[model samples]
Target: MRASIESEDRGNSMKEQIKYGDDVLEIELPDDIIVDRVAPASHGGAKACHSLRDDHAEDTYEYLYGKIHQALIHASTRIEKCGKIVIACDDNTRVTPVKQLVPPIIDFADARGIPAEIIIAGGSHRKMTRMEREKKFDKAIMDRVEIMDHEWKEEAVFSNVGTIHAGDESIPLLLNRIACNHDSFLMGIGNIVPHSVAGFSGGYKILLPGLSCEETVRWVHYLISKFPSEAILGIADNPVRRTINSVHQHRKIDLLVNTVLDGSSRVVSLCLGNPITAQAQGASISRRVHGVPVNTPGDIVITDSVPESVDFWVVAKAVTNTKAFTRKGGHLIVFGPCDEGLSPMHGDALKRMGYDAPRNIRSRVKGGDIPREFLLEASHACQVGEVMEHCHLHLVASGLDVDAMASIGLHVITPARASSFVRELIEITRNEVTGRKPRVKIIHRGAEILPLQ
Candidate 1:
């Protein structure tokens, strides 16, 4: 839920309830902090993300379901004879409405006496636990189908599909064994949103980096680091996107389901058709819906990583999305309720490396000081490091080590009380004159919201 909130002066401070994941949190700002504005997860004109909720949810759902059903009907010849199908879906990191949208395909298959299994497109992220899976899909759907996840570490499970470029270097493009099965129909599912690496999320992403082998995942991420994020973030078809679309040449997926969600996590619109065309169609609406106008960059920008996520990895997204609004040499406050702690899969690699600028990391990797094994982690570092170049980042969250993050250029701060962290943070970062107030902007759903100047 988005927060229809405005900052209110409360004597010596200001208080406002902004979107904190699926809930709202009352953030008390010190008197010295000026709340210049607040942006939200889903946004367009009216104010923030909360104001964009589509109250006619039932109509929207029925409409999208019917649309998807129609597409499935056309593919009946193959779907009916196949006996089994594979459903590709994004992991929990995305707020995709999998529970609501996925069932249509499953039901279609079941009615035709066909079985369906779900493959979690985890990318290089860790496996989604049963609890996360439940949250990601319909509870009942879990019992009816076998759910599997992409294993980036297991070389044996992947089949070398073809070759894709990381830069000038050509790398082996590998996909899962099941994904290689051309006999069954594969339905790729995800929501479209602005993204730094892929231009926009969904489409070919749910297949290439989503279920690709370790080498493919690193190649995709590494290719993106070579471009400035501003060029890719919300662009319909950038170079990064064009390169990713190349994967479709190898894998012949029958259909793709890409939906656009409002700030309230309700369906705004959905595109169901060829993966490339559908993603392009959905991204157009996504750009229009998610693009929030920014008056000016803020002296202090506050962004949040919602609860129960992949820790700093999720926080890195919040940082990437919100960094554009932080004036150079300004402060960027990261509000992360990281229940999963620092990346469970890449924590060791992260701890060993610092959040150096992208060029520095690039130079070290080129010098062969940093090995190729941590290529994906290197990509993560470069994304986060890009933000550090423009602002002084202060990470305020749980499930993180203070000294560990501090050593990597992240100034970690935690309050004795959760409610006091923001206020205490303001006091500690008082770089201005004693009587001066600093301008602040709060990006409620920092990981998904896009700010347009």
Candidate 2:
């Protein structure tokens, strides 16, 4: 079952509760502070396939594999003869069920006497641990195919694939050597969800940020700072996505198996064909599933980054997604259990750069002030800066210390104190606006939903 908002009202006070990690956070607000509209979570109904549960008999790996095999066969013309195939799978941050997706592709390759391997497209994030691998993959599949993680720092694992000169910026394309050397490359990706950078995540993104070297990933991310407002959730034609598509021309993707997931992370729709076309079709479905139409911007927005937890890095998705629905200079509060801090590698870089606003960060990067090692992390800092530029950000994360949150220009608050702090902020806002009640919007699954205009 999908997690949803549960509300309880008593007298003049209204209490709304949402799942935050393993616990529930109760948000108490005065009736006036609450808005009539509370965005619903995208639980794509009974028509969509549910996750593998005892109640559902058809949600088995055998059924999923049949769908996967048909898609692969229809899209893959030469999978029967391809000597070496590499499967580009998403890292742990994504909810894609790689274990179920990989077996069918491997079976096809094995039948054709082709060798195949799985590469975890980690991008700049740290490598997945043994436990994470076990969680994502089944023992049977793990025993059959070799699985390796992309090492962005290791120079030998990458090869230069020319450069993409987009709008005065020359970004060198250094991709994973294994992916480039394969006779055929197949990408197993989740649907194109609303993303901070690429308009939607999936498609060519599985290559650029997924399997690219640090230089390629950093430069493209830095390019995103140029058009922060345009790079919004639910948009499919943003500058960052255009650049990613341009870079994709350097390498040919044989087939793409993209799945649209419901709120419960079940495979709802599967698209297979040319990577671009399949992803576009999946993105269309994603827009329908996750897009929430807003008649007007909210004065105060409260959201949580659940499921996409473990670090403030992924949790920041809630801020970016909420930014689209917030009024200019309004307060955006995000609460999550960021147990991994900012990020293991990018946290230090974010602190060093400070949240100097997006414009200032852009100028510095343009002038080459950012060090090479920190460029990828700086790109992330730029994203935070861009979000801060549009709204007053308040982050309530227990894993991150006050100093760390402050360093990133976020007002830190504990989960227990979030309601009180927001209540006071709304009261102050209401008084300043001549007793106008604040329009507060609560998003149950902020990271997953796309607030559209």
Best by lDDT: 1
**lDDT at position 87, candidate 1:** 91
Question: What shift in Å separates residue 286 of candidate 1 from its native position after superposition?
Answer: 1.1
Candidate 2 local lDDT, 333-432, one digit each (tens): 8888888888896887787777768778777876878776666676677777777878889888788888766755777888889879988988877876
Could you tell me the lDDT of residue 99 within candidate 1?
Answer: 76
Write down the RMSD of candidate 2 (Cα, Å).
3.8
* Model 1 lDDT per residue over 101-210, tens place: 77788888889888899999888888888898887886899988989988878998898888776567787889888878887788898988778888788898888888
Q: Any runs in candidate 2 off by more than 4 Å, and if so which?
A: 1-11, 36-63, 75-77
Model 1, residue 86: displacement in angstroms? Answer: 0.9
lDDT of 1: 0.75
State the weakest 10-residue window (summed lDDT) of model 1.
43-52
Q: What residue pairs clash in candidate 1, if any at all?
A: none
TM-score to native of every candidate shown? 0.89, 0.89
Candidate 2 TM-score, C-alpha based: 0.89
